[model samples]
Target: MTSHSFSKFWSTDLTRDSLLSLLDTPTLKSLRLVNRAFAATTSRQLFRDVYITFRSSTFTKPARMAALERIGWNIRSVTFVINHGAEMFLPPLLDPLTGEEVCFVFTPCVRTTTPTSSPTAPASGSTSTAAGERQGVYGTWEMTDLLVKQYPPLFHAAMNVSSFVAALTHMPALRHLKVSCAGQESTHRYRRSVVDYALSSLRIAIEQAPLPRLEALSLTPIHPGGIQYLCPMAGIGSLPNSCRRWTQIRRLEIHMDTFPFDKGQATDHLKLLHSYLQAFRALRDFKFRWVGDGHKGPSPLSLATEPALCELASRSQACPKTRHYLRPLKFPYLQYMVLGNAVLDASQVSDFLTEHRHSLLEFDFEQVSLRSGTWDDALAPWRTLSSAEYDAAWGEKQPAEVEVMEVPFVLGPSPEESPATSSPEQYSKRRKKKKKKRHARTTEVAVNNDLFASTAAMLLEEEPVHRGSLNFRTLREGLSNWARSKGMFWGHGHGHGHGSSHDYLHKAVQSPILV
Candidate 1:
């Protein structure tokens, strides 16, 4: 077909959305070869969110970037991810139940930077092209200078900090910037310390850049097969200088999987948090997630999994008290705050709420505990929830919220790794003892639930009274009256709920804890 005729035919053949949908990376390259119109359309789509990975062998980045700069204004976000690995860094296989490393495989490091040392070669078994490219990039004066200035020992480490800053300075429309340091240490060429240095250098570079349009920032680490050890609070304390320039930033999230849970580290975190809240005056939403549980499992090895940290156990170990108190800080524009797996005391929580109550619309307390001095003190916050106010506020359009707070009232014994005696007779006896203990715990849970229900019925009365005048029947009648008044049915587990002993005991066991 003639060029003009072909252009006209393709343009009329597919709609914009349909045309764009058909253009994956390989397909886009194929389409670009077809005609000028196809090339223009494909180029626009490909350059929308420019991605640059320094170590990938798939394509030459400098060449690709030169192509994108011609249409750089079309780009909205720039993502820079550095991959590094150290010779001694081994991936861990975790225990299913406890999340601890069950075994580890140690292997000799492979030299990836040197082309001749690479495992794969070209179809013709030639090495000149690959070696030339590697040497050209690494041997460049600019690249060597960058490596020496930022990360000296880790030459293969992706030191794109200065490049990122330079890139950010040029891109006027870029609003989102994500820089991640993950799996950066490779087998043969690795520097464990350089990872932090690289990350810190990246932050410093960002500080030097002026990005007024930048709105969202995510600085995270990605570790393959295992959990990442996040940068310390001291390293994060450097952000105020960088973030001060980010006035338009409305959303800020930082994930530190390796934050220590000791009292001293907790103090440091609180200090950092205060500084952040004070710094981001225009921030509308803030989220801080520390201590990532590896493999999303109930990691007994994690300090976050300890009963003392989250109040997970009914009987908790006494923690060394800290006399230090959190000073009040305000976030006038912050609408939402999420502090995942973070433990704060009642006073600290109250202070946070009071400071941000004007603009704070939502908060998440996932794995969060508000440690109170006493049970009554803990319940004091909910004591003033007026039924009249609730009735008025909840309507057809806005529904009242019902939360089922799960409190662990009974904790089973921790599983033993192995029996002390290896004898078959002793092992058999141990197994039997363990089974009996498990059954006993189940029975104990049932008894505890029944006791709690009877206590709630007596104590949680509509008309408050002293212990002498406590009445369960009156409380039941009051609950029934309120249910009828609300035009809601209260189920006594007659038809829908099984009335068998197994089900009854289950209800009696689950009610106090689950409800």
Candidate 2:
């Protein structure tokens, strides 16, 4: 039998797991060439992740589009990467007084003249230029309008949107859609306009068709209005009715690229947030972050400063701006709440936590400035719940006590840090000397280890830990030895990975080293 025939038979007989074990892309692509049987088995994996990049040279070409069109059915995830310069024309807003198009920005006029004896000369009626002109005689805005309207297929505009949507609609099995536009567009005033346009297109496309399997979405919007555009409100920007179709989405992450700069007043922003959050009913994990510019960590509260935060935190009463909007929020299905770089009113936040305490498993607030020393006060509602109340609601007994033991263990420098030397003998001596030092420290800490192990073993037999600390290094080392000497105790603790907190706590009570 030929090698191809043998491989074909082998591929057909292999289990799904076996086929998936072949990790390299080239190998998977080659398997499709082996035979129809191999092709059938491998095609799903080959086209699972589809990436469409929008660039000046490649966006117009139909090769990538054709491939995507053919195999879009196999796509499970699709990512759209738009280039920096791809921008849409923002038609001049009409002036109320003159009722004429008035330029919002100061843009210089650019005139063009046809060259003599050029084969690609302007048409008889035409004033000037090629289709892909970087700058038109009128200006960048005019150039953008020309490209988007005249040669829509060649530019990242409505045509691109329609094509992308068509491709997405073709994939019935798609679960993830990510639209990323990095860097500012030179022609456009708002760098986020490209992202806004892309999302708007997707929203329109989604309204027309059904994406039953889509459950996760990720995108970065530079403007606050872009979010409003993506999920349009019903009446007076109250409820986002357009996002009703996205109820199937369980995970939504919005990256606000220029948050502090673009953000509105705290109340106005929070009102917008309340409207947006109400749109997703079945969402489990929601993350909204403002990726600061140039700062290493989270952006400083530029708009929502410390004093304002303190004022908000000082009172349990919700902000007047968002009081009505946030009063109704009780995300029963939410499991993870990760918010960063944005300030939320303390009272509203407390109310949210109290309402969702039973459902929320993990809550993270990174660089979220609040009134100084008010974090505990903000989370007080959750802590104030009685043990009986917790058990009644969650069907799990809360830990009655907490033990904190600090076991000191020396964290010496790594033994592998040998000094640089010209002589091999010198290098060998340095290594030996480091090993001797480590051994001495280890020997000296032998008594400390015994003390650590005994404490851990004793704590294992006690009631569930409410809140406590032990030297992590000592606990890790001592626990292993203690487990061997005394049978492993199932420590009553949170986040034991059994999925349900009830199940985890139940098992903790039922089983004896409680981690």
Candidate 3:
């Protein structure tokens, strides 16, 4: 067929399934640019999943805004990197796609630099720069400042430090919000003063406006020290009143670097965790990681589980209306649970798995040591059958009439060697020479014995019983003949063989055979 004719025929003959398959191929991208008809059809397929690469030097804020604006309102998902200023980038991306449910990923730029300082360098004069700092100044953007300056309402409405969250207040279709800060400095900046300021500002802004539709919030703060600051107990007291607006939040993940539970200020931390659970009654999944030094502390969930502190856990049982919080803990709704060096007693882990095992699909335990008896108690219920029963159920088929045999050999000093009393030096030299000869002879005898025993066992186990056919006398004579041919001892009980058969068996068992 002619090229034009083939093209026309293929296009007309393509089914919906075939068209989708064709579009998935790498060649389709080039094919789409061939003609307007191909372009129009392929544009829909290409734009269905919107992916923006922020690392490209060509991709500026305005260009990104224009590209997103041009994609129309049909874009469903977006994956983008925010090297330095996610605050500036996220608002516009979110602003144009308010009607559609979107997923926003913020990945920090990877640092690429070699260390130049020695470990012994003086603290004051150390010239080494942090990995994040080595990425240049423009590579870092304060998330709180970026939000405050750009998207104030979404920031305020979502209880995020960034003002950019304001952009989502009116976005009823907003479903997923993921924010991650990179490195310790960024985390410190976010938690120390930025997060508090942002939240405080957001509270004020939300009081002016509210987000009734936002559902899922995932915040990963990389600063270990920032978690205590972000999830402060005192802050929890104020959040109960101010956070009444986020009634729709169902999934929350607060990833931190350090959760200082031993700082004697954990009462507020406990209260804040409880308050979040209380505020979001619709919540189904909650995860928290203790990033601080893992010293055992008062359970954050203890207070929340308490009837006095958390009125939610107390009043209802089925689909309880009260707050349900899992602090470095697992829950029934948890389809995926990652217990990272959590200080949970064996019973707690057992209880959690028992309640959630039916629904739990993925479980990860990192640096999570189980207490004694925990494993047996947790897994014993799963092992219903004994080893024999289990083998009968699932064991592979075995061939009939398998033979097994046992044989023993003994090693003794050479007949030529004489026992004698001598000087210390003479005795030492003689002992050394005897030790080497003994080792060599023992190894040779052990190897020969194993081969003979294994051959006998196999023959006995596999051969059918012939009337009066199997005889030890004939077997011994044949072995002696074979040993003579192979340059091994063949005489009647040479060396250690002069001892009892039981003694020979002991030597055979004790001798070390090198493979």
C-alpha RMSD values across all candidates: 32.6, 27.4, 27.5
TM-score of each: 0.45, 0.53, 0.38
In candidate 2, where is summed lDDT lowest over 10 consecutive residues? 110-119
Question: What is the clash count for each candidate, in the order shown?
Answer: 9, 11, 22
Stretches off by above 4 angstroms in model 2 are 1-15, 18-22, 55-66, 86-156, 159-161, 185-195, 220-223, 232-241, 261-273, 294-328, 344-348, 388-515
TM-score of 1: 0.45
lDDT agreement of model 2 with the native: 0.55
> Model 1 scores what on Cα lDDT?
0.48
**Sequence-dependent TM-score of model 3:** 0.38
Top TM-score prediction, candidate number: 2
RMSD after Cα superposition, model 2: 27.4
Comparison by lDDT, 2 against 3, better one: 2
Q: Which candidate would rank higher by TM-score, 1 or 3? A: 1
Give a tens-digit lDDT track for model 1, residues 311-350. Answer: 4323234753533333345567877777666654555555
Q: What is the lDDT of residue 177 in candidate 2?
A: 77
* Candidates sorted by TM-score, best first: 2, 1, 3
Q: Cα deviation of 121 in candidate 3 (Å)?
A: 50
